[model samples]
Target: MMLVLLLLIYTSQHALAVVVEMNAGEMSVLLPCQFSGFIPDDPTVMWTRNDLVPKSVHVQHKEGDDFQGQNQRYRGRTKMRPDALDTSDFSLTLRKPEMTDSGNYTCSISGGRGERTLEDVELQIKDQQVEVKVVEGSDSVILPCKTKHDLPEDTRVEWTRSNPELMLVHIYPHKSDQRKKQDGLYRDRTAVNKDLLRTGDLSLTLKHPTERDSGGYICTIYRDKDILRQKVVLQVKGWFPPWATALLVLLVLFVVSGGLLFHFRHYFMSVYKVEVDSGVESVLLPCKTVAHLPEDVKVEWMDSDDKKVHVYQSSSDHSDEKHQVYRNRTEMKRNLLRTGDLSLTLKHPTNEDNSTYTCTVYNREGNILLKKDVLLAVRVPQVEVDSGVESVQLPLKTTLHLPEDAKIEWKDSDDDHLHVYEKRFDQLEQQDQVYKDRTKMNEDLLRTGDLSLTLKHPTDGDNRTYTCTVYSKEGNILLRKKLELKVKGRVQVQDQTGDIRNRSSSIDPTPLMADQSV
Candidate 1:
């Protein structure tokens, strides 16, 4: 039974341990240590620092304990909660952390076999804020990333380039550890505080920092497997401020104000181009006036046929055309007296919808306030043959039928200056030297837009990219296809003795002979 009880106590003790975590730059922190299987009796807990002569202390649950040692830096600053001990809370609170207060600390219990555990807390103190000013092409300026934290003796602090393209001038931890490079323009300009490494003072000094160095920089502190990082920005400036800097600033403000006025005037007066996708059910056309006009102003929307779609005069009255095609499709969104929201929306679209619409606004005095026009282009997909395909063979030629209104243009890729056939004009009988007597299209299919051209003598050199562009009253459409020519030829040689040998004798020789002769 005694052995069983001992095993239970051991398991409970192992299950209950203390944990301490300190955030960077935290001044006060609670180091909570848990003690399981507590009897609630008067327990004695003590804390100590890891130093040459460790500062130790003892505390009682009833009366508070203060453990300020001969180290004047941490005097009268450590304490623990009174109720924490009764509830098995052995947490220690450190006050006002300093550079000297960084190291491993231990929390131990003197009751029930005297158990103790050690944990380390790292304290990082940020460096003083610095302002850097440097000029372009001037001498290198040094910006330091420093801190005031006491680190381990063998800790390594480094200054690495945040941007790899920029080279490091130098890194100094000691006089003998100075690194210098000849090729880098900033070779002899960078340095750091070497003596402060053990104390976690990672201050970086940049030498000859250029305008390119006006970015982020990192200072890293490495100790064993732990790392602490800090970042700072180095700004490069041109020159210093003078007594008349305020006047110069005012002058700049005046110039900027004038420039903004000019820009707004130009933007208000300039005509804006409106583009819309085809098949759109509705579109809002924006028309806004610059300044205030008389409340009794008139606005109207006119289509290409000079037909009035909608008209608005005064704030309460609107005129509509009953017989218009777009009777319910268009309306004015706002009044011109307050907001110039002359935006209009079209309800449904049709192929006959291709036209340029005009927005005209007139003031009460019958003077034109604003006049703007927007071209509405509706688009449809049309299949057509591109320009560069000089010829098509027998099998491919049968697939040349296209839909209606498909515009086809044929031009030689080798010589674009020559036109093979234009839809508005008849086909040219004579071809250019490059395509001489080699290209022709089916005459009957030409009326229906079958623009498949056939080459008499196809060659590999005729392979080229052909662009087929189709235009409609709505808009323009484009498609591209590549044509590659593969020619098959037969050669025959007859001796004077009348002995004739046939090339490809089994095949019909007429087509091959005719193509080769061309």
Candidate 2:
């Protein structure tokens, strides 16, 4: 018994051990192993993963490489040097690794005498995390999935939700999408690119996504024996109107209309409603005042959290005193003091930038001189439609009736006027030529408050952001909305059986858990 124990210990010493780490979407990774000294003729090299059935990962002999006993997961993804045994190098190359491929692998060698352990390799594969947030009433949202490798033509793509519950969201097999087995919750709500494999962009578009649809989604691509997966988290927030603030604003307007503007001149500050897309490079916070102020006064902009956004003093900019969140991202006009236009330009504004900003002017003694408040709503609601559709509508619904003399204008990101309305009628004189006859609106939009624009014959060129602005006769912006339009090419799919084969070892999804080390 002692001799047998000694022999086992001796055999363990011959096995070289190593560990490798790689991300899930990577192209390939190498498990290294090297042996020196004599190599017998007609030798055999074998690799196996103990936990997997049909443990054979790869095998090679004097004849050539063999796959008769290999596991289905490693059928077409495992490779080694042609002259591995002759050179005593028994490394293996794994292509398109996935989260399920993390484990321990054993390598062995045999010849005329007997078999012996060669090496042991431990692999750890991790998935990259991505998060996307959208408002509850958005038309659609995209869960992006991009891969580096060129997958096979016959690859099968499967999108599944693992968080909250295990469910199948979408599937594309062979050359078309299969929806029969899709979860009822995602029925008629999911779409993918027509030529995903060719473009390497397998982004999944979810239409009319609600808060219930928010969760962790896994996009798994199956190409023959290889499985690649990536994870994305989606968050949908519900919209709630601030009723008290709206009532206060109405009271302020009532007081101003009663010729009491002079009484509230020191207390009332004009509010400007600014809406912009999150994808925009910059947004201007308008705070113009005609009141003359002391030359030694300081202008400071602050967010709802009272964090300094931008500051100007001593006849120059003082960005060092701004909050770290706005560092290097806030700018002001050079002649703000001269022009009395204390507009703050914020760069690369995101969802986190959505809040009310206060601009306060202070004298040399730190006493408030004048103040203005600007409410910035950075929203980019996406609306996707197929090019085959006859027309697409940019929806904007408000319960309150707009001013009768208000001029509503619809303009694209390129400054092209898509539609215009003034004096309760369509104003086509200033409309862009490209949208002269392609745009339409309701007859009494001022009363109905449904300023949705319908664009006929949507095409790829129509893919851009459209901004809707309502201005009163005094040239004050009353309302603004930004909507992103995506016109995708139509996809033609035929009814056929989902050509699925060589599914991953763990076909049924397991709950997203912490990473395991082997």
**Candidate 2 lDDT for residue 313:** 90
Report the alpha-carbon TM-score of model 1 versus the true structure. 0.26
* Reference-based lDDT, each prediction: 0.52, 0.79
TM-scores, each model vs. reference: 0.26, 0.29
Tens-place lDDT digits, model 2, residues 407-473: 9999998998999999878989989999878999987788888889999998878989898887879
Highest TM-score scorer:
2
Which segments of model 1 are wrong by more than 4 Å? 1-46, 49-111, 115-220, 225-248, 253-518
Instruction: Estimate, for each residue in 186-249, the C-alpha lDDT of model 1 and write its tens digit.
Output: 3444556656755445666655454556765556555543445555567775344564567656
- Best candidate (score: lDDT): 2
Q: 323 in model 1: Cα distance from truth in Å?
A: 35
- What is candidate 2's local distance difference test score? 0.79
Q: Model 2, stretches more than 4 Å misplaced? A: 1-299, 302-377, 492-518
Q: Predicted candidate 1: what Cα RMSD to the true structure?
A: 28.7
- Candidate 2 lDDT score at position 224: 50
Q: After superposition, how far is residue 84 of candidate 2 from its true place, in Å?
A: 99
